[model samples]
Target: MRFLSPDFNFWIWLQHLDTPDNNLNIPFEFTEANMRQVKEILSHYPSNYKQSAVIALLDLAQQQHGGWLPVAAMNKIAQILGVPNIRVYEVATFYSMFNRQKVGKYHFLVCGTTPCMLRGARDIEQALLEHLKVKRNEVTKDALFSVGEMECMGCCVNAPMIAVADYTKGAEGFTYNYYEDLTPKRVVEIVEMLRRGETPPVGPQDSSRIRSGPSGGNTTLLSDPKPPPFRDLASC
Candidate 1:
C-alpha cells in the first residue's frame, strides 16, 4: 500500500523494515481448523504445483495472524507449501493487500482512482488522517486505526469510498466493510462509530442512496415499456 506522503519511497522503506514486536520471535503455525483449510486449498492444485497455492495460503496466513503477515508466518507458509522461503516472501511483499508489518484494529484503505478523486477522495482521506491523528499507514498510539491508499475498488458509482478491514474480532470475526458515497464528515462519523464498538451500516452512506443507485431516486424506467411483437411461423 502506498503511503500518503509525497516523499515516500517504497523501495527505500523496504530496506529498513519496522516490524511488530516479537514478530519473528514468536512461532507461527496454522490452527487445527486452519490446517484443515490448508489441505482444502492444496486440493485445488496438482500435487507437483503446490507452489500455485502460495497466494491463497498467504492470505489465509494473514487472516489467521490478525491481518498482517509476520516473518514467522511467511516462513510457516513456506513450510506448509514446501516452497523456498523466498517464494512466500516474494508473494507477500508484492501484493499490497498483504501487510508486512502490524496494522491497527481497523485499517482504512481509501480508493484514489479517478472517480473517487473527482468525488473528493483526497478530502476524505485527509479527514480520516486528521481525526485519527496519524499519517497514512501509521497506526494510532492506541493501535485502533491507520489509513492507506488503494486503487479502484469497483465502487466508483459511489465514489470517494473507504474499505475498512476490521481486525478487532480477529480471524473469525474479521470483516472487510466498504463505506461508499462518502464525505469528509460522513467518513469521520463512520470512524467514530467503529471507535465506539458500534457497527455502522455498510454500503452507500448517503441517506438518499440505496447501494449506488441514483442520488435522489431512479430517474429513468419510471413507466413500463410496450411489449415486443412476436412473429408467428404460421403467418410467414
Candidate 2:
C-alpha cells in the first residue's frame, strides 16, 4: 500500500541550486488568482491564527498546480501563514491525499488493506500495473495513468474498490470516480475507457449489486414485515 518513497525534501534544497532543474521543472508559485483564494481561506481564521489555514491553503495550491505539492508552493504558503517552512512540510507529508511528486492525468488508487486484500485487491492492482505498464506510483510513459495503493476507503463491503482521480482539465475542477465490486478484467477495462478519453460508469460495476448491499439480490429483506400490535395506553 505504498508508492515510491518520495524524497520529501527535494524542494528544500532546490532554491540553493545554481541552475534550474530543467525548463519544465520551474519553481512552484501560487498564481494571483490562487493567492486570492488563499486570502479567503485565511479569512476564516483570526489575524493571529492564519496558520490554521495551512491545510486548506496547501490543498488549494496543489489543485492550482496540477495535483502535487511543490516546495515553492509550501514556502509561499508558509510565508503567507507566517509559519516556518518546515511546518508546511509537516502537514504536506502527513497527509497521503497530498502528492509530493507529479501524478498522471488519472491516478488509479487501489485499496490494499486487509479486507481488500482478502477480496483480491492484489490481483486488481496487478492488472492495473500491467495494463498501464508502470509499477506502483510510476506514471505511464504517456502520462495518462499512474497506479498507487491506498488504505481502506471505507468500502470494505465493496471489498475491492478503486478511487480513480482525474486531474485532466475540464468544465468542472477535479473529479473522483469510484468503481466498486470490481474484478481484474473490469479494472483493466476501466483504464482502457480513460485512455480513450471516455468517461466510465462510476459506482458498482456489477448491475446486480446495489451500493454495498448483498450482491445479486436482497435475500434477507425479501418479505415486508407486518406491524406489531400496539399495547393499550392504560397498561403503562
Candidate 3:
C-alpha cells in the first residue's frame, strides 16, 4: 500500500472518496444453491439489519469468482445487500484478507512477524521468491504460485510458517496446507513438489521436530515419576 511518490499516494487516497468503479462489463450471479445459502445467512439478522451479512455475502462472491474479488463481484454484492456500491468497496479495501487483484492457484501467505522473523522468515521468503522467479504479490508466469507476507498465523512455536491456499482446486475441494518450522532449503523443496502436482508433508518440515516441541528430543521432564501414595484422612 506504500507509494514512493507522495503526490501519487495522495491521488490514490483520493480514489477512496470517489464511488466504487463497476466499469467492467462482466456479469456476476449467485446460483440457486448459493442464493439459498445467502438467504440463510440473511435470515440470521432482522430485516433492517440484513446488511450485516454483507461480509459473508462478499466472501461467497469471492469464492465464486475463484478466490479474488473482482469489481463486478462487489457490484453484485452491493445490489444484493441494498447498499451503495462504495460501501462494499470500502469493506473490501479495508480488509487485507480480501484479494482485490488476481492471485495464483497457490497463494503462499508467509508469516513474517516477530517470532517468525527471529527464526529466519527472511530466508524462507527469499527462497520462495527465487523459486517462483517473482517478487512479493507477483504471480509466476504460469499463474501457479504467488507469495505474500502476513502478520502472524498464530504458529509462533512453529515459527517461519506459511499457509498454502489452493485455488486451482474448486471450492468444494479447496485445501490450505500450513507448512511450518521451515528452512530455506526445505521451502524450495516444498514448492518444487507443488509445481510437480505432488503433495508435500505439511506441519513441521524437520523430521526431528514434533509439533512445536524442541528439535531432536524432549529435554525437560525426561523421566517418568511414580505417583505418591494416597494418605487416609482418618490417619491425620
The C-alpha lDDT values of all candidates are 0.83, 0.78, 0.78
Worst 10 residues of 3 by lDDT: 1-10
RMSD of each: 5.5, 6.0, 5.9
Candidate 2 Cα RMSD after full superposition onto the native fold (Å): 6.0
lDDT tens digits, residues 142-200, model 3? 98998876678888888889989888765566787899989999998988899999999
Whichever of 1 and 3 has more TM-score, that candidate is 1
Error of 1 at 5 (Å): 1.9
> Looking at candidate 3, what is the lDDT of residue 54?
83
lDDT of 3 at 122: 82
- Mark the 10 consecutive residues where model 2 has the least summed lDDT: 13-22
Candidate 1 lDDT tens digits, 1-236: 23335544334225425444535678998999999999999999999999999988888888888788878888898898888899888887678788876678899999988889988998999899899998777789999898877789999999978899998877678788999999999999999998999999998889888756777799899999889998898989
TM-score to native of every candidate shown: 0.80, 0.80, 0.78
Off by over 4 Å in 2: 1-26, 170-172, 216-236
Q: Mind sharing the TM-score for model 1?
A: 0.80
